[model samples]
Target chain A: MAKVSKEELLHIANLADLNIKEDEIDNYLKNLQDILNFANIVNNANTDGLGETIGENDQCNVFRKDEVKEFKDNELLLANAKEQERNMFKIPKVIQ
Target chain B: MDITNLTVHELQEKLAKQELTSEEIVQAYVNRINAKEKDVKAFVTTLCDEALKEAKEIDEKRKNGEKLSSLAGIPIGIKDNMCTKGVKTTCSSRMLENFVAPYNATVVEKLNEENLIDLGKLNMDEFAMGASTEYSYFKKTCNPWNLKTVPGGSSGGSAAAVAANLVPWALGSDTGGSIRQPSSFCGVVGLKPTYGLVSRYGLVAFASSLDQIGPITKDVRDSAMLLNIIAGHDERDTTSYNMQKKDYTKTLNGNVKGLKIGIPKEYFGEGINEEVKAKLEEAIETYKKLGAEVEEFSLDIAQYALATYYIIACAEASSNLGRFDGIRYGYRTENYTNLKELYKNSRSEGFGPEVKRRIILGTYVLSSGYYDAYYKKAQQVRTLVKKEFDKAFEKYDVLLTPTSPTVAFEMGTRSENPLEMYLADICTVSVNIAGLPGISIPCGVNGDNMPIGMQLIGNKFEEEKILNAAYTFEQEYKFREKYQPEFKG
Candidate 1:
């Protein structure tokens, strides 16, 4: 069973966009390696040529009539917002 | 007037007979929710006031002698993962903690049209990831029979509430064995409709391809009734089937005589606990006595199901959950210098360990170099698994196995060993792999007095046959008749 090196773990975490605390890195690396090693058993199976299906129901291109739909009151919708502006949600500005 | 205890079919029957008003039925269930839910921790929120208001309108319509649908006034637990137009549909996760859906799921809309009372949201595995309700960010759902053990999850709360008679039935989504395993542990009927049978528009995606919303109830009758309400085509859900739904209740009485029931040798293997095996063997004998021909069968691809399922489910989950980053809105971090840091920090803090583990594994599989060996290969194996089932079904009308290898273990027992815990799903994963319709019916009590369930699998779109065999076994076995949940106030 190959273990994920500390450097590999850090690299994968970076790709996942996660920054593991330095103290947490070692254990996360070991645990993740265990899971990966465990998953290698799946490699044992031979999947030759089956097309990938994202979901069941062979149907595609279902169309709904486009129409206005009433939903919750806007007052209730933004009631819990941390910040609000002009009856819309406000968040940390991206370009700041 | 405790109609919450009444099966939906019976409640519908009573409403049709004018013996109970819709308001009265809804109020009955609402009252039960008020009194009992505090103990079971089944619901994330109780919508009794809202439900009663709707119930009153339903009553007014019926008083004017309007046409009443079968689902009208029947209270049903909607798993938190399904979106409700104005209700909080949180997926029992902190990520969606403050998120209330703006649109209803396709099934929820169908139930609304059918006049089913929303019993608010039942808790679930955060993002439908775990096999135990323990993973929910909300309060843990307790098994009604024994509070110490888990209710079996990510549909744990759905099964627990139903078993406690807090509500007669509820809707649940099955990915892997979420519905069936929990049903077995909670001692209720849980059906995973043939994929695409019921629409998944509102179900929060775990593994989109593997997810199917279905009914978890005290009996198969309610499963059929709920199926009737939720099964149909919806433009919003492209995967929803356009196939004909022949009132599933009608199929309940279909004769199982001469039906070929396949018994897989792999399912009854050395790994199965002795107690679960005894009950399953008894169930087979009972089916034989009921005039169904039992035949031995093999699914050559069975051994590979879990591995394929994990790779496929995790890969999809990794992508589906990508929508939850701290951007358009789910959980956003209190502090982050930039978008990248925000996404990373918020998700790392938000998702539980099991979920993070899966996302990482899935991410790796779908990553550039490993896609063929992991993701693509798993897809191919999934095909082989499906092909194997197609062959088996050609020789048999239905397949039977123990729903789970053992009864519910201690809540935290397998929490440490993810591999050991995943093994618990061994018998049930194949049905999901084949995208076949399957139902878990109570067989009898294990000597320890825990519930045991027997699974019945049928060919895709052949739910009628599975229901036929299950109904026959249910009727003849009479185990469920004596299977009372030992709940105390």
Candidate 2:
């Protein structure tokens, strides 16, 4: 069975952009390990000559006319934003 | 008139005859919701006022002798994941709890065009993740059969509402077994259409490739009726197929003679409850009595289906969920020092434990060093599973199996162990993996008198065959009245 340690769990949480609380780490680790072990069953599958399936169908490169239809609900669109200024989403300082 | 007990078609007939007004129908459902919502806990929001307003307008249109769609004036609920313009489309998560949609999902739009009254948004597992609705950030939806038992999820609310007759029908999305399994537990008809048959636009994505919105209703005919209205091409959803238009209800002739039904032995193995097995066997015997050929076959790829489904579903979810950064929409955290911390903290605070677990597992499998061992291997197995289904379909018209291993379990029974919870999806996930259409209808009652469901899976775009077969079985079984949820609470 696959096992996830504290360090590994922390690293994964970081990669996934999730801030795990200090107390929840052990629980997360144990659950992650259990899920990974369950997922490890795929390794036993006979996929010697099988190709990976990324989607259900093969019709790709679907192009549409780049028509710019104006959406009239700008205020409604901005209603859910955490912080908005000058019709744009306001964010924390990015440049150091 | 017991408006709540009537099916969609019956309601339509009454409306046409002026036997019942849309206002009366909507008011009846509102009363039903008021009475049942506390125990069933099915809806996140009830649009009683809006539905009444629209129902009144639909009645006006009809009185003016204006031609309208057959579905006009019927009340229905939408699963919370589907966006309804100007309504909060929370996927039963804190992240999107207060986020109102700017546009309606295609299915919702289609229903709106038909003038079907939107009763409200139904609850579901957070981001449609867990097998039980207990993972919902809001209230947990209990099975209407017994309030102590869980409504199988993540479309638990949808199934429970229909079973309890809160609405004639509702919409649900299936990524894994979200729709069908819940319908099985709640004893309603749930249909997951062929993946691209219905547009996924405005559906909050969990796994883009696997997700498809479908119907949960009281009977096979209602499912077919709803599918007829929703199953069409939409340009916005590029993945939506542009097939020749099909009126699904036209094919429900209830004739399954000479139909080849394959029973997958893997689905009926050790973990399945003996009673559930007996119920399915009884259903198969009924099918045989209808002159349909029944045979058992080994769908060996079933062993790897669950693993493949998790890997792909989680990987896609990890990528898809990255959109909820707390900047544009969804929940935002106050405790953050910088931009990176903002992203991390908002997600951590907004999401529930099960959602976090899936995101973590999803990220882990797709991360470096483990990608080939887990994600890629799982994808390969997915292809193999699909190929195996294709091979099976060549010989059989449809595959019949139990919708779930058991009936509705007690609320807290499987919540503690996530793996135990996932096993509930074992019978239905392979249909999604293969992108085929499958329907669940009640076959009989278990020892506890809880409903047991049998699944009928068809090849891609072969829903008509399954519907014909399901309709045939449904007519004979007539379990709808016998096993109907009586609201135990």
Contacts from the true interface found in each model, as a fraction, amount to 0.44, 0.92
User: What are the per-residue Cα lDDT tens digits for candidate 1 across A1-96?
Assistant: 456677766676677766678997766776666666766776776655567645555566677778998764677666545567898877666885
DockQ of 1: 0.45
User: Lowest summed-lDDT stretch of 10 residues in model 1 chain B?
Assistant: B480-489
Q: Candidate 2, which CAPRI tier?
A: high
Model 2, TM vs. native: 0.99
Clashing pairs in 1: A47-B380
* Candidate that scores best on TM-score: 2
Which runs in model 1 stand beyond 4 Å of their true positions? A48-96
Q: Residue by residue across B1-489, what tens digits does model 1's lDDT show?
A: 456667777887898888988788777777777777777799987788888898888888878878878667777888999988778888888888978776788888888888888877998888988787888898888887777788888899999999887777899999998999999998899999988888888789999888999999878877887888788776666776777667888878847778898998888887899999998998888878778899987665555888788888888988888877765456777888776787888888877777877787788788887888778877777777887888897899999999998898777887766667777778877788778899998899876568898899999988888877877777776665676767532
- Residue B85 alpha-carbon offset, candidate 2, angstroms: 0.9
Please write out the lDDT profile of model 2 over residues B1-489, one tens digit for every residue. 689999999998998888999999999999999888999999999999999999899889888989898778899999999999988999999999999999889899899889898999999999999888999999999899999999999999999999999988999999989999999999999999998999999999999999999999999999999999899999998889989999888988888889999998988898999999999999999999999999999997665899889888999999999999999999999998999999999999999988889989999999988999999999899889999999999999999999999999998988999988988888988888889999999999987889999999999999999999999999988886676677775
The list of candidate 2 runs beyond 4 A from truth reads none
Docking quality tier of candidate 1?
acceptable
